[model samples]
Target: MDVKETAAYLNVSVSWLYKNAVQSGLVIYRFGTGVNSKIRFNFSEVEAWVKQQRVMGG
Candidate 1:
């Protein structure tokens, strides 16, 4: 998914994703270089990462 779509999927702001996605462990796919580039996320990988963050209820 693109930045907007990925942000929507995570219920986060686009700027937050740009600032934190990599440092927080999510992967990003970039196509081309420079200001006019496209980025995407592997939907399943993102889902897996989120799942790994799950905590059991008390």
Candidate 2:
């Protein structure tokens, strides 16, 4: 998934994703170099992360 898709999946803003990229469970991968580089996230990883965040309640 790309930045936009990830943001939508998380129900957050693109800017928020970039801001929390380091702390967020989502991992960002970069391809190429310089301005041509692109970022992407593993869909499965993101889903797993989401599952890990689930809370059990009574």
Candidate 3:
């Protein structure tokens, strides 16, 4: 999904997704070139990551 869609899905700010999710090595597909590059995410991968981040019972 696009930045807006991703942010809404994650319930986070767009900048947070860029800084944390994208910058921290999460996979992002880039379209176009140079300054026009666009980023997209795989929802399944994102959902898996979210599941991985979940804390188990204490």
Best by TM-score: 1
Q: Name every residue pair that clashes in candidate 1.
A: none
Rank list by lDDT: 1, 2, 3
Tens-place lDDT per residue, model 3, 1-58, is 8988988988999999888886655678889999989999988888887777779998
lDDT, candidate 1, 1-58, per-residue tens: 8899889999999999999999989999999999988989999988998898899999
Reference-based TM-score of each model: 0.90, 0.83, 0.83
* Model 1 alpha-carbon drift over 4 Å, by segment: none
lDDT per model vs. reference: 0.92, 0.88, 0.84
Error of 1 at 41 (Å): 0.4
> Model 3 off-target regions past 4 Å?
23-25
| Among all candidates shown, the one with the greatest lDDT | 1
- Candidate 1 achieves a global lDDT of 0.92
Flag the better candidate by TM-score, 1 or 3: 1
lDDT of 2: 0.88
Q: What does candidate 2's lDDT look like per residue over 1-58, in tens digits?
A: 9989999998989999889976976788999899888889899988988999899998
Instruction: Assess the local accuracy of residue 40 in candidate 1 as a C-alpha lDDT between 0 and 100.
Output: 90
Show how many residue pairs clash in every candidate, following the order shown: 0, 0, 0
